[model samples]
Target chain A: MQIKSLNDCNVVQMEEKLDALTSDEVEKALMGLIDNGAKRIVCVFELTEYISSAGLRVLLVVAKKLKKMGGELVLCSLKPLVYKVLDMAGFISIFKIFGSEEEALKSPQEK
Target chain B: MVQGVKISLFGNLILFLVKATALPFVNSLAILSDLGISCVALAISIILYYSIKLADKPADPFHNYGYSKVENVCEAMEGVVLIGIILAISVQAAMNFIHPKHTNMPWVGFICSIISVVINFIGAFYILGLAKKSSSPAIHAEGLHYRLEGFISLAIGISFIISIILRLNGLNKIDAFVDPVATLLVSFMLIFPSFNLARSAFFKLLDASIEESSKMEVIKLLGKYSHKYCDFRDLKSRSAGRKKFVELKLILPEDIPFKEGHALAIALEKDISRNISESEIMIKVEPCGKDCHYIQKNQRCPYL
Candidate 1:
């Protein structure tokens, strides 16, 4: 999956679903974005379903990356069952989630 | 599956006899019209039972898609039957309006309508509970059938009682007209449920996406992964009831060993399974290149 960079913020709009292999590619893409000074990225999951532990670990890495830079990461558009898994893993409270892609893009965070 | 239908079948039979037998004796048009709907309900229940049994069967070499569409077909057939019955009653009721007869046996019909209503209510509640427990489309359709029958019966009872009230004031002709008017009213009741059932069954038969929310969730997950990967594009999915089949293409680093990349795919599969139940994922891990799009779209290698 490709992470398209937004002109307005460090947030990246992911265009596909993330699994272990996909998450690795996503991590590599995030590393490139992080190198480009992209901080406090908002990840959009508009076309994605099912995130495994490997996928979660990738997100955790991104969260860690943002934390070191005093930035944040947010997730949006999780289905009830997927959201349930995230909830079970205590990820809901850890990440900021908006109801929609547009809302996640504009989620208020400390600059 | 057949057992569920048998229960509904017996319930509908009782409702029909109560309405049909009592309505003519009581000289109430509305109750008689309502009674006609019971026949439709019974027909639908029998069809539903057969369809449920068929749909519940596992896929075979002859039918790879399983038998899920059987339920939808049964539902659509039920809708058609309902429409036909409603039209027949309307025509019959119109004939009665042209030659109205004095009704002295309305009390008898009224009692019968009451019995039908009680039976329908019990049947609807029972079938609805079973539908919920089994998640069977046929059972749900059966419950809806009884529920509608119950409503029609109530309407018929109310119309007759009004006729009775009017007859006491010496407007005997008004009592004669109640049955015809009730027939027209019952026809209107069938319209909504028939249209709704037909539409849902058609959609299911077409294999249309039944769960948009789930798809969106999947999309969002893919988009999130983009932060780590690049050149990810082209995702497709189809749903078979509760099962979701997903296919996608992703770009992996060329330097990554083939074994590592294969492992990555396996890991991603696990993630998808964890997030969505009964999911199958097919991934094509491609290297970032100008020919990638062509390869995905045309399946031809420009270099070759």
Candidate 2:
């Protein structure tokens, strides 16, 4: 039940299944970070399993808001199941996906 | 499994004979009522023996659903017959309140009732264990019936012991009333359980859905795996005898390979069935077919 929110670099470590029941909590945490003027986010899904449609909706909304604010939402270390769902939902082409948190952290400077 | 039923059959017949023997030597309506139920149980055990055999038969061309319903039929029929027997005894017990026949040789009846109680309890526990191990509808029904029989015998035994103590203290007049009161109390206690047996049979016959708690467990599993598929609908469930059935439509991605879809469907079924015993699950895996909103908008959706 414990979800550690954005740290010094706006990196949020996600865990477990993110479905209809849990998507709201995740949305709230991510939205809070954006509202507090935090940007250039890195979401690490090393411990995450799958993201349902509701979860995808949360990502889509946050990613769109971040883009409007001239910021970016990056994802890394996605399990196969999460990857398949995001790819199927057309989210693969929307956000910057990386193999690890270090690669995601270096992407902003590379850009 | 058959061994358990056979033991109960012979054990109940012996208890009935012992009670019948004590009935002639004593005058107690409580003992009479207990003996009456013994007779009913004997008949039921006989019917149940054959029903178990028939119920264990595998599904054939003639009976695609198998013979499990035989146990339900026997339970309904037994319940109705038991209610009738109880009603007759309750009336007789009421008459005894006015006439107040003196209870004779209550000590003998007390001893016989204690013996019946012990034997019934032993047999009840043994059969119940067998029922759990086998998971046969017929055997489970038998175990429940035996447990009820044990309770009745225990009640009768307590009544007889009280009557014997009353008579010994020269409270013969009050003791005369004890038997009838005990009979009426035991008869009323038996009604709800008998009615419940009949009601459960009817529910199963009507193909009632499983309990809500069990359905919730299945829903939780679906939620955990919701990401694999787009959406699911038409979650249906039912029960026949001890067997549970669950059917639903699983909407997989349109481009998902057939082999992966099949494996996902099988895995889902296995996970669900593990929570429900004696279950059969059927899932229809279908392509999204423009089901999602993005697909309908002709967006960059994979399924589209």
Model 1 per-residue lDDT tens digits across residues B143-225: 88888888887887777788788888998867788878877888898888987887776776676653544454554455455
Pick the DockQ winner: 1
lDDT of 2 by residue, A4-105 (tens): 443435888875877667878888988888888766778889989877655665675576555434467889999998998777555676678999988887
Positional deviation of residue B206's Cα in model 1 after best superposition, in angstroms? 1.9
DockQ of 1: 0.05
Model 2 chain B is weakest, by summed lDDT over 10 consecutive residues, at B295-304
Candidate 1's C-alpha lDDT?
0.69
On the 0 to 100 scale, the lDDT of residue B49 in model 2 is 87
Each model's fraction of native contacts = 0.00, 0.00
Top candidate on lDDT is 2
Native contacts recovered by model 1? 0.00
Residue-level lDDT tens digits of model 1 in A12-36: 6564556645777888888777767
lDDT: worst 10-residue window of model 2 chain A: A1-10
- Whole-model Cα lDDT of every candidate shown, in order: 0.69, 0.77
Say which candidate scores most in TM-score: 2
